[model samples]
Target: MRIEIVEGDITVRPVDAIVNAANSSLLGGGGVDGAIHRAAGPELLEACRELRATKLPDGLAVGAAVATPGFLLPAKWVIHTVGPNRHAGQTNPALLASCFTESLRIADGLGARSVAFPAVSAGVYGWDARKVAQLGIEAVRAYAGRPLEGEKPMVELVEFVLFSEETAGIFRQALEESGGGPG
Candidate 1:
């Protein structure tokens, strides 16, 4: 697998799937979630509404993930995962790691070759950026190292689309420190 750290908008990425750091509602909120919803246009909301009306009536759980078609965005699919809210006293790093893990699992199921991701829980959720970077990188690395049930990994590329250079640097450092070699 190839891992990349990029400072840009994930909505514009030409990957097969893009992961949204969404709230449980999955309808759309502030930060990356709102950007993805707007970029994907109204159809994205319609799809999400259908998801809520049927499959996810109670809303998505934190760390769990669901996929929707990326209507207007450059990506083909959008993988939505709710990050644990630090303000809500949810301090488990496992929850944050699960965000990355579950998203990749869903993307793999979709047969996505490339996926872009934002720094989950590092924005309005109030998680520390460095820690989030560390956990996210670790989770992706571990997942990539282990092929699924004797099948080759479907997702080949994982790109971290950071909103700022500082965040990108943090992720880069974490990746390098984790022996991922600046990817």
Candidate 2:
């Protein structure tokens, strides 16, 4: 898989899918969630509401992921994953890694060639940026390293869309340290 670290808004990424660092509700909250909802218009909220009323009545679980149409966003699909909130005492790095793993799995199921992701749990959730970057990169690398049965991996490009240059640098450093040079 090709991984790229770009500093920008994920909502504008022209990939097959964009992963949202959503709250458990999935109906949209602050940060990337609100920005994506606002950019995708009301249809995104309606879709999320339908999911909530039906499949996810109690809301999504941390480390789990579900996909919805991208609506007004540039991407074709929106893969929403609830990252573990460290402020809520959910400090497991594995759980944070699961967010990236599950989102990529969902993207593969959708036959997405490329997917863009935010620094899940590293923002208002109060997780350490360096750790988040390391876990996020490691999870993607490990997932991509696993061979699929018969066919090649559906998702080829994994882009990290960070909000700031500092965050992007952290991810780049992590990627470099992992021998996966910044793309």
Candidate 3:
């Protein structure tokens, strides 16, 4: 398995799946969410509305991913995961972590070999870049290095696509200091 950090748009990744930093409503909003929704076209919104109609649990918060067609994206599927805001406090770290955990679990189940993710909560969710990078690095390291159930599925690439140079620096520094990430 390999973990890569890059500064770009996660919605455009050609990987098997790209995880979206979605809200509980699953409705299109600003930042990465809006970009993804726009790039994926109207079909994604239709799909999300259909999923929302099923009545998901409230406070279910994190690692709760649902797959939808990629539409215009190169990826075959989009995995929507809700991340917690930092205002919720440190006790909420696990909720953010679960986004990665659940995203990967869904990917593993879908036989996705490669997945790309945005900085899940750093935008409207208000997560600090450094902390999010640290947590994200640990999460990816813990999972990306090994495939679930010893089944490779060729699951070798995991990408954290940063939108800013500052965030990219944070991720790089974290990965460097910990001696973690794809070589």
Pairs of colliding residues, candidate 2: none
Q: Write the per-residue lDDT of candidate 1 for residues 1-183, one digit (tens) a residue.
A: 888999999999999999999999999999999999999999999999999999999999999999999999989999999999999998999999999999998999999999999999998899999999899988998898776676778998999999999999998998888885744
TM-score for each of the candidates: 0.97, 0.96, 0.89
The alpha-carbon RMSD values of the candidates against the true structure, listed in the order shown, are 1.0, 1.3, 2.1
Candidate 3 local lDDT, 81-177, one digit each (tens): 9888766663478777788878887888888889998888886678888878888778777666565676654556888899898888888888887
Which candidate, 1 or 3, would have the higher lDDT against the true structure? 1
By summed lDDT, which 10 consecutive residues of candidate 1 come out lowest? Answer: 174-183
Model 1 residue 111 CA deviation in Å: 0.4
**lDDT of candidate 2 over 22-125, digit per residue (tens):** 99989789999999999999999999999999999999999999999998998999999999988899998899999998998899889999999999999799
* Positional deviation of residue 159's Cα in model 1 after best superposition, in angstroms: 0.2
Q: What is the C-alpha lDDT of each candidate?
A: 0.93, 0.91, 0.81
Q: Write down the RMSD of candidate 2 (Cα, Å).
A: 1.3
- After superposing candidate 1, which stretches have Cα over 4 Å from the reference? 180-183
Q: What is the lDDT of residue 142 in candidate 3?
A: 69
